[model samples]
Target: MCGKRIDHAEWRLTKSIVDIERLRAVAAKHNVKIPDDEEDYYRHLLNGLDATAQQVADLPEYEDPRLQIEPETLPRQWFKQKPNPLNGWSHRAEIKLPSPKDKRLDNRTVAFKDNVSIGGVPLTGGTTPEILTGKSEYPVPKIDAVVVKRVLEAAGTVSGSANCEHLSMSPLSFTSFTGPIHNPWARGYTTGGSSSGCAALVGINQVKEWRKRHGLPPIDEELGEGVDMAIGGDQGGSIRLPSAYAGIYGMKPTHGLVPYSGILSLFPMIDHTGPMTTNLEDLATLLGVVAGYDGIDPRCTPETPLREKVPDYSAQLASFKQTKQAAGEWTTSAAGKGLRIGVITESLAVPNLSPEIFKVIQEAISQFESIGASVSHISIPEHLLGPSIWTIATRAGIASLGMRNMPPPLLCYPCPDITPPALSQSSFDILDRHNPASANMVFNATLLQERPDGASLAAKAMMHVHELRAAYDRALTEVDVLITPVITRMHSQHPSLDAKVEDKMKPAIGSTLNTCQFNVTGHPALSMPAGWGKAEDGDAKMPVAMQIIGKRFDEESVIKAAAAWEVGGLGLDKWDGR
Candidate 1:
C-alpha cells in the first residue's frame, strides 16, 4: 500500500486482530458478514494501518529551551515541617532565585497552587494520600512548570504549594484530601475552590491567629503588610471563585495567555492559570511575569504569542490615572471616570441569589457611578445556558476522552502514574485502584456507557460551547467589560468532615454559574471583592465579589477596571486593615 512493503511484524499484528471480538461485533452491527476465513481481508488492511501508526509515532517532538530547562529547587526535607498557617500550604519552602537582570517581580513572595509543579515539592493537587502525609510515591518533577520557572527567574521567592480541591475537580474547599480550607473571614465557612488555599494565603487570612493557636511566634504585622501574591490555575473559575470568597483580586486571563505545559488539566480549552493578589500592582506584576507562550503548550496561538520581554501591565493603570489626572479628577472618588461598565442581567438574576448579596453588588455599582463611570444593564440571554453547556462538554465529552487514553481540546500534559484511590472503570482512572478524591470526575466518564446515545449527546454539547462563546463575544462588543456576581450567593459553611461524597458534591455543583462561562469563551475575566454582606443567620459578615469580563486577550482592561474599583474603597472596609 502506497508503495511501502508490509513487513513480518505488521502482518503478524494484522493476523492477530483479524478475528478480534470487536471487529466481529462491529460487523454484526453494520449487517456486513465477514467470512470465517478472513486472512486475505486482514492482510489487505495491515500495510495501511501500520504505516499510519508509524507516521504518528515518528512525528517530531516540540523543541524549546523551557522544556529542557531545569531550575534549582528546594530539597524535599525543607517542605516537611514548614509553617502551614491557615492550612493553606501543602508544602512550604523558602526557595529563592535571582533573575538574570532587573525584573518587575524582583523580591516578590509568591506561592503556587499545588497543581503547578515545583520540582521536588509533592504535587498532590490536594487529593493524593501520599502528598497529604508529606510522603510521595511518584517521582518529583525534575523541572518546574514553565510559570513556576518564570516566577523564580523574575527574582520571586516561592513560598510553597497551596492546597486545592481534590485533583482540582471541585469548587468546594472541603473536598481537598487534607481537609476543609477555612475562610479567613469566618472560621467555619468555605473558601471557594479549587484555588482555595491560594486565595486564603494571599489574603493573609487566619495566619496570625493560626500561629497563635499553634503556639508559634506572632507575625510581625505592620501597616500594608502580608504575602505579595499567589499563582492559581483556573479551569472553570478555580482562580476567580476562591479569590472572590477571600476578598482579593484574581484573574483568569484569556485561555492561552499562559502555557499549560506543566500543569494538570481537566480539558485544555477551558484551562488557564493566572494571578491572585491583595492589590492591583502585584496582580499586574505577576501576570506580566507568567503571561506568554513557552512553545510547549499546544493551546497557545499566534494571536497570544509569548513575548521576548514582559509588557508593563501597570501601564494600563497609569493610563487610566493619567486620563483622570488630566481632568483634575485623580482622587479616589474619580476612580472609574470615563469608563463604561455593564451589569449583566442574566448573571445577577440567577436562581436562589441571596438578597444581601444583591444589595452588596448594587452598592458596588453605585460606587462605580459615583466615581464617574456610566453603568447600564445588558442582557446576553445565552449566558444562562452556560451550566448546561459546561456539563455536557466536561462530563460527557471531556470525561469520555480521558477514559480512552486521550484528553480533549488537544494539548494536555500526559496523565501521570499516580494510582487512583477509586475502583471504577472511568476513562480518567489512572490508578490501579480507586480513590474518592477523583470520584466526581471519574464517574462522569461513565455517562457514555450509562446512556445509549451519550456520545451523540456530548458531541451536540460541544457545538453549543462554540455558540455560547460567540454569544459572549457579541455582547462584549457593546461594552468595554461586563460585570456579574462572582457567585450567585455568599460563601457557605464547609461540608461536614464525615459528609458522604454525594453530599459534599451537592453544594459544589452549580457554584460556578457565572464564572465558568468565561472559561468556555476563552475571555479574560477578573474577580474583585465588592463589599461585605451579613451571613444567612445575620450574625456573621462575609465578603461579596463582582466579576468583570473583557474581550479575549484584553487582560489590561480587566485589570484596570478592578484597580479602579479597589481604589474607590467600595470593598476595603471589609479588609482587616493590614
Candidate 2:
C-alpha cells in the first residue's frame, strides 16, 4: 500500500516504520552508539505499535443506527420567524410523525430545545451558524433521536426548536445568538435560560398575543389545540430556571431516568432532559413518553428498570384527588397527612435574596400545614458550596477535557457519516468581544492552567459532590421532600447587552443557586409556581416559585406533593399576564 500521510486522521499511527527508521538514521549521523541489541529492541517496539494500529484500521467502521433511511410518514415545515413573540424562535418547524396505536399525546403540541435533534434538520446547540442557517456540512439525520422517536410514537406533534443559551453553557438566556428571550409575564424582563424559549412558549397570554400578531386565529383554550409542552435539556438549571421565571411547571427528573442520546450536554454525568409544561398532568404524560432506557446512551445507569415498571404518573394525579384534603373538611383530611417536608434553610439564607421573593416562598411553605404536611427548617451547610463544585466539575472536568478530545461525528448520536459542526469562530469571538474578561478568566485560570491543578480540582469537586449527595440522602431519611426557592430572586428587567461581564454574571449566579446542587446529586426536582409577587423596587407583578426535591428515582413523591399543592389552591396554574 502507498505510504499513508502522517497527518491524516485515518492513519492512526503517529510514528510509522519509515519515521522510526529516519530517527535511527539521524541518531547514527550524530555518532550516537546504539548497541545492536537496543536497535533490534527499538525495531521490535515499532513493529508491535504498527501491528496494533493496523489491526484497528482493519476493523469494520461503525454504522450509526440513526442513518438508516425510511419513507417519510410525516412532512416538516421550516421557517425563520412565523409566529414568534418574545424573541424565542431559533427556528420553527412543524412535525407530524406517525404514531403507535396507543396514542397518549395526540392532543399535545410540544417544542424542543435547539439542542435536541429533529432528524433531517440541523441540531444547533445555539452556536453553530452553519447549522442555524441550514448549511451544515453534516448529513441531515435520517431518523429522529430516541426521545424524538418516542414522542412521535406517542402521537405528539413537534412545534419547533426553541431558542437556548449558546452551547447550553450559560444560565442566562441572553447568551444565545438569537437574542434574549423576553419573559411573558412582563416585557423587558428576561426569560431565564438555557431553556428560556421552552417555558415562554407555554405562557397562555404570550401564545395568545403572538397568534393575534401573526393574524392567526386565537388559541381556543377550550379545545386545547396549541402548544402544550416543551422538552428542555439541563446540565444545571436550564429547565427549572425558565420555568421559575415564566411561572410554569418544569421538572429535572433523576439523572439516567431519561436518555440523553440526542441532546447536547455539558457533561455526561450532569446532563438531564425533562418536561416543561403548563400543568402537572401534562408534565407527567410527557415524562412517561420520554423517560425510558434506549440502550444507546452509556450514561444511562445499567440495571435500571424500564419506565414501564414505574407507577404511571398520569394516573397518580387522580390518587391525590381521592384523598380527604381534596374536600374542604380539614379535620378529616387525609391528604399530605404525616408527610414530612423540610425547607432548605441554606437556599433561602442567600444574602441577596429579594425580600419580596422570600416572603412569598415563606407563605407558600407555611401552607403545607393546612394540607396536613408538617414543615420544618433543615440545614445542609455544604449546600452553599454547590456553585464552586459545579464550576470545578464543568470547567475542569468537561470544558478542559472536551478541548483536548477529537471532535466526534455527532453529539449523543451514533452517526458516523455526519460531519459534526465545528465549534464556530463566531461563538468564541462573541464571547471574547462581549465578555473578554470572563473568557480570559476561564482560559487562563482553569483550562490553560497547570494540567495537574485542573485534574486535582476536578477530582476534589467530584469527591465533594459525592459527599454532598450523601448528606442530602441522609437528610431525606428525615424529610419526605426538601424545599427551596427555585431562584434567589423573583424577577428582573433584562440586563443590557453592553453590560460588563461581571455585572452580567452576578444575576446568573443566583439563577442556579438552589437548582445546580440537585443536578450534581442526580436527584429528581420540580419547580412549581407559588404565586405572583411584586418585582423588587418595581410595580410589575411577577411569578415566585418553590422547588421540591425528592430522593433519587422517587419522582412519584415529588410529583404527588406538587400536584397536591396545586389542587389545594396554593399553586399558580397560569400567570394571567399579571
Candidate 3:
C-alpha cells in the first residue's frame, strides 16, 4: 500500500529533496555545515507525517453504528444575535491608478500582509479570531491602512490579504489557526513569516490567479509583457525574509517614512509598513503614494515628500533610461552626488549563519565595489543591543496587552477537564463586579514584575543605534551610499511542530541582528534581491538579498540605488528559471 503511494509521494519528496540539497550545497560551498545524522533527521520528518496521517485516519466514519450521533440541542437565545452589516463603506478610500505615461512600473500583482487592514476585507493580523470568522460580523473598517491605500492609489489593485503569523509575532509561518504556508519555490522548506501568505501566493502564481479572477490583467501583461513587482510590510524582516524565500525585492522604509496609522502593530516602536516587488520602480512608485504624513499618526513627519517635493521620480527614471541608452558615464552624481557607505563587521560574524549566506554577502559586496560605489567596513559597537533589547521589549508589551484584554482564564494553558489551577481562582474572583479593582491590581502587579528590562536595555541599545547613525552621517561626509547583505542566511528549513521552543528561536538571529538595529536607530533600510543561493531541495532556487541603508529621509537615493542594481541584473529576475 505504501508502495502504491510511492510514485505520488516520491514525486513530492523528490522535488523537496532537490530544493533542500541545492540549498545545502550552496551552504557547503560557503562553508556552512549541516547536521551529519541524515537518518535521525529523516526520522524526525517522518514523525510529523505520522501524526498528520493518524489524525486523518482516525476521523469518524459516517456509516459506523457505534459512532452514530445526533446534533446537540442549543439554547433558545443562541440563534437570535443581531445582524451585522455586510457591505458598509470602508473608513479610508484607496486610490488605484495606472502607471504614469513617462515612467511606468512593470505591471506586477502586489499582495498585502493581512496585518494591513483594507476597508472591506477581514483585517486579522493572523490573530483575533473575530477577523477570521467567516460570518463577517466585524464592521467594514472606516479607513484602510496607509500602505494598502497607497498601493491601490499607485495603480496596484487590492488583490486580498495574505496569511500571517498570529498577531504578527512568530518567525515560523506555521500556526494552529491557519495551517503552515508552504514554500512553492521549495516544497518542504517553510516560507518565513508573518508575511508568509504574501510570499507564497506571489511565489506560486496565486496572486496572478486572484488578479485574473478579479478582472485584473496578469502581472506580466500588466508589466508591459513581464510580471515585475510585489509589495508587503516589514516589522523585523517581514518583507525581507519573504522576498529572500520568494526571490523578489522588499523594503523596510525608514521608521515613520510610511505612515502606519491603520495597521495592526506588533510593537508600536518598531512596526513599519513598506513594499516588496520584483523590480525597483514598482517599489519607487508605491512608496510615492504611501509616503506622506497623516494627521492621525503622530509618528508621521511632514518634512519629507519625495512624491510632491522632489524632481518627478518618473522623470528621473527616464533620465536613468536615457543614460543607459547613451552609454554616458554612470556616476553617483545623479543619485549619490554626496554620500558614504558603511558595512557592519559584527553583523557578518553573527553565529550559526548558514555558510551560503556568507558567500552571498561577500559576492554582493564585490558587486557593490564593481559598481563604482566606494565601500569600507565599520563597527557599531552599540549594535550588540539590537536583538536582546528588541525581544524583551516586544514580548513584555504583548504579554501585558494579553493580560489586560483577555479574560484571566483564557490566558492559562488549556485543560481538558477542570479549569487549570493558575487561572481557576482568578476566573471565579472576576465573576463578581465588586472585585474588578482587585483583578486590575493583580494583573498590574504581575505585569510590573514580569516586564522585561526593556527600558534599561532599550536605553543602552538606543545609544548604540544613535552612535551608528552618527557614524553613518560622518561617513556620508565623503561617500555616496552604504551596502550590506540584507541578512546573513537564506530561509531555514520548516521547523518541526514537535520541536522544543529553544530550537525555534535559533533561526531568527540573522534577521534580528542585521535588520532590527535600523529600527532602533530610525534609518531607512531596503532589502533587494542580489543573487540566488542553493536550496536544500535541488529543483528550486533560494535568493540572497542585499540591504541599501541610507541617511534619514533619503529614500529617493535608496530607491535609485536599488533600481541601478536591478537594471544591472544582479538579482533573480523571475519566479521560475528563465
The global Cα lDDT (0 to 1) of model 3 is 0.53
List per-prediction Cα lDDT, in the order shown.
0.72, 0.70, 0.53
Candidate 3's residue-wise lDDT over 433-487, tens digit each?
Answer: 2122223334544564455763665465546555666766765555445665665
How many clashes does each candidate structure show, in the order listed? 9, 0, 35
> How well does model 1 score by local distance difference test?
0.72
Per-model TM values vs. the true structure: 0.83, 0.82, 0.65
Better of 1 and 2 by TM-score: 1
List candidate 1 segments past 4 Å from native.
1-34, 39-65, 69-77, 81-83, 129-136, 205-226, 401-438, 448-453, 536-538, 574-578
Per-residue lDDT for 186-211 in model 2, tens only? 67776788888787777654346444
Worst 10 residues of 3 by lDDT: 73-82
* Window of ten residues with lowest summed lDDT in model 2: 400-409
Which segments of model 3 are wrong by more than 4 Å? 1-108, 128-140, 205-231, 302-307, 310-314, 321-327, 330-341, 392-395, 401-465, 536-540, 573-578
Task: Evaluate residue 494 in candidate 1 and report its C-alpha lDDT on the 0 to 100 scale.
Answer: 74
lDDT of 1 by residue, 1-578 (tens): 56566675666555343345656666778797778788455535654665677787798544345643344443433354334545777777677663434466777788889887776676776665442222355445545788888887888888778888776766767767677777766677778888988887887733344346556576533201236789998878999999988878899999889887777666776889999987777788888888887877888888775567546688777787788788888767777876789888998888887787788888888877887777889888988998877777776444544323254555545534333333334322322122243555556667554788877777887899889988878777877788998876677777666656565566666688998888877889988878777765436677788899999888888877777776677474644422
